[model samples]
Target: MDGTLTINGPKHTDGLTVERQEKPFHPIEHVDARLISLLDMAADSICLIDDHSRILLFNKASETLFGYSAEDVIGQRVDILMPQKYAEHHDGWIARYLETGEHSIIGIGREVQGQHKDGTTFPFDLSVGVAETENGKQFIGVMRDLRARKEDEQRLRSLQTELNQMTRINAMDEMGATVAHELNQPLTAIILYLQAVERKVSKLADRGPITSEDVEQLSDLCGRAIQEAQRSSSLLQRIRSIIEKKEPERTTCDLVEIIRKAHKLSLVGFSATDVFIDLSAPDDLPPVSVDPVQIEQIFLNLLRNAFQAMREVEQKAIKISLKIVTDEEDRRDRLQVRFQDTGSGIPDSHRKNLFKAFDSERRNGMGLGLAIARSIAQNHGGSLDLAPFDEAQPGACFLLTLPIASSPSDESEPKTESSESMDGSQ
Candidate 1:
């Protein structure tokens, strides 16, 4: 009876009793530390929660992303890491998933907002998975920050917008040149016919018994027609100059004379006759080496803008002042021209984009006057800017600055002459 019992495979042993015993079974832990450690080493944040939505496992990446330690979040409700609104309804969603097993966010990746320990929310990519364990069902979520990707997308959109704007500007330039060419032909013909009619009427009056009043009225009408035709032609010339790609012809000329001619020409319309112009410049000022026509055009634009701005004002005046500016070393470096108008000052909202193409505050404005004027100024080694408004003066002021030519021979290269042919009678 004291001898040990022995059992053989499918056989009985003589002179011994045999017995078989079964070993007890133990269930594995719901979370394996080794597996969690592997997930912790990943770049994306990994988190695990139990059936009750309590955080069961938090990896190193998760700790860093949520700005919390594992000890702070373990056994805590998983909703603490989500936005308040999402947290409030997250439990119901989990319950629905467990009851119906219908896929909503489970087993799918999507974009969502993640809340950090500091309570700041940021965009993230979230992918969730469900697992069944001896302890019950659990959820595993992987989160990746989207801040960098979003910034890249924003930059791309900005570049696309800039490209679109440049394309529009190029198209406008082409259209403007074509329109100017088409208009110049009809304008030239109109002027020629009007001139011929004036001559015929004069000859008829001399041979017939035409009354003095009739002759005077007819002459006045003919003169006004001719003037209007010339004005139209000049406007076309200005449009052509603005869209012209060739270098302008530069010559030595007096800036004062240019200003006077611009002042006179800008007054041709009824809207500008009531506006008085005051000019000031030093008599000993040196001649500027520039395109006289281009300079006059700049003055004309400035004066026209001033007149338009002052149309409703009781006091209508434009003050033009010129001075030679010297550098720090006392060497003559620039010429400064200031045009100040007694009119309604530019609004603060309009100041920033004042020189941008196609941006204007006037109802009948083309929005190119200031843009082209500034461009011409910059092309001539100069700048045009709205001067600071004087509180006492109560008007708008513009300053034009140009670099003085170093020498008389500092000229632009000669450009090829281009001309258009049009029949005046047609």
Candidate 2:
């Protein structure tokens, strides 16, 4: 609220003298006694000054804050309460405001240093306001001490640093094991293919002439071996990027391609032959603004979660669909990505803490996946949620919504992407 207080009552003759003077002193007449009482009883410091910046009135709280009695401060220049450097600029600051009617701090409050009579400076929050009086214009300042609040903020920062350190250590432990598990699949496949080549070579040495059939088989084995090697290399590179701690680099990219890559990565150690994963999206969808690596990490978490859920079931299936949610009035439409898994739906007991870190009953992980995924989504001005599971269908559905990137032209390539399906063969 502004400094000027309006109280309806008859004025009192008893008022302080701090106006036009033989020596910068003039009498303030017709001041209300109730107004004087209110200022004296205020919890925060209050000081009023005239056009010359000379103190017209000093409340009791101001006396306590500055270690100066009302008698010692009234009629003194307001600059005396601040440091010498600030005091030098005080006259000019007020002159500019009075001349141009432009405000620096008059209408806005800010933190500033206030010097006590003992020659020590302390931080205080100050807000100034101006009012027109019958005699002239007066400026009122309200200030609050900031020492206790500053100390509390410092303590909170320390605690947060400690908590972050511990979380990183714990996450590293879990992530290391996951990397080994995923790498084992491609590495093992590569080894098996190489061993088969060795056997084929040994057999060829015994046989005299090599047939075209023999060359085709060897070529096929080598190609498969190369594919497995490439898989291992790609997995390592992506995981390495994820492990490095750095500021997120946000950019616009194709969301569908990111989802496709993450789906391929998530199946690294899972039984892909027995499982059916359908990823359906529109051919022409606008790009989304996101930190590509972080967004990929989110999709990986969600896909792996679905994979883990269907591990024990004979009929396993995962369906992921992406679409645009058009709400023109909102001025920004969002991309909706939904993942559904056909397995034993989440138990009633585990639903409450599903997204909480280190709290999952069915996962081999420490349960940081969904929690981290949600955090990343929110940081990108998006959201991830577990939609209600249909008991009849017996599956869990996760919905992630992200904002589409803003383009120069309103024209979009086309369409939302859902209700359509791609076979697991891809």
Candidate 3:
């Protein structure tokens, strides 16, 4: 029985069979109908390809898969099933294997691209097996459609994303109390300082010459008061930037200066820690079109989150890195910022909804910070994503991406304007 080919008989130990069906065995022509009867009822798409990757046999399943009747494809080249992009390389693969006896897909099951009757490409998982015979070498491929499985997986991911967003919104609400209190302290201080300064200035102006020293000190105090007012205003701006449902207004701005200011602003509450902000961009990394203030808020939120995650750890450090990246898919430039921390890592359970608004893992925190942070990132035509904090140790890293301007050196440098002295005409 060795080397004897069979259509439906059990495979022998030495690769032989009892009955061979080398040629088409039609029940009407042949004495036996067993082989033809077996062919009519298979559930999977079955096809036979020769050494040159030309279709030799097509079954009922093959017709249903490619929207073609068996008669239309039985003698055609197998490259018709592959998409245009894959067809070129596929011919080379077939020829190479025919000569070298090397097989990448034989006896293997894999996910591959398939072109339908309408020329639409879809995913399919195909399992292929090879058999040798007196007529020629043939490959039998059993294909399973994967569109349904892909859809189900996509639905699950969408639901998970929604749940995470809900959790983050809740976290933000919890943090509201802390944010409000922090903002109020500065506002209240600015009010008291302004009132005191105004009263002192009015009394001194009404009395004597208000000596040069007195006037100079008063001007210094006024500048300090203005700075305090600006601080309070900046806090409100940051909060409103997240909670307000509005799109970012893009403007050309210096990224290096923006990062420096944001880093300085974020350090207000973080004490007892050493942090570093590092920025590198192509000198040609042009002033990107972005909502500068909103970008600042995003950086602040990420920096604050990193600082909080690392605050309790012994290392007590966080780093901010900014760079320009190219998007191969979109064919555009992107402004990328990475906030890396050396702190206690996030628990496995919390990773899925980490960017969700108000989804805070900490009991005392309202999860809104990261959620709002992500919202702002998206509003600016970008995304915020989290990754493993470090390769060697433990921690988490957050990535912020924004669309960059077309080029860096496009603007004409403006002439510096002089400050004019104002007369108190009013």
Which candidate gets the maximum TM-score versus the true structure? 2
> 39-87 in candidate 2: lDDT tens per residue?
9999999999887788989999999999999899888989889987677
Q: CA shift at 387, candidate 1, in angstroms?
A: 1.2
| lDDT value, residue 409 of candidate 3 | 51
Q: What TM-score does structure 1 among the candidates reach? A: 0.41
Sort the predicted structures by TM-score, highest score first.
Answer: 2, 3, 1
Which one wins by TM-score: 1 or 2? 2
For residues 243-354, what per-residue lDDT tens digits would candidate 1 score against the true structure?
4544468887888877866665555343465666777775555577788767777887787677777878998877777776764655756888888888888878777888
Model 2: residue 93 alpha-carbon error in angstroms: 18
For model 3, residues 184-254, the per-residue Cα lDDT tens digits are: 87777777777877887888879967889877877777787788778778766755554454434789877
My TM-score estimates for the predictions, one after another, are 0.41, 0.57, 0.51
In candidate 2, the residue pairs with backbone N, CA or C atoms under 3 Å apart (3 or more residues apart, or in different chains) clash, namely 19-26, 21-25
Q: Any runs in candidate 3 off by more than 4 Å, and if so which?
A: 1-43, 204-426
Model 1 error, position 1 (Å): 99
By lDDT, the better pick of 1 and 2 is 2
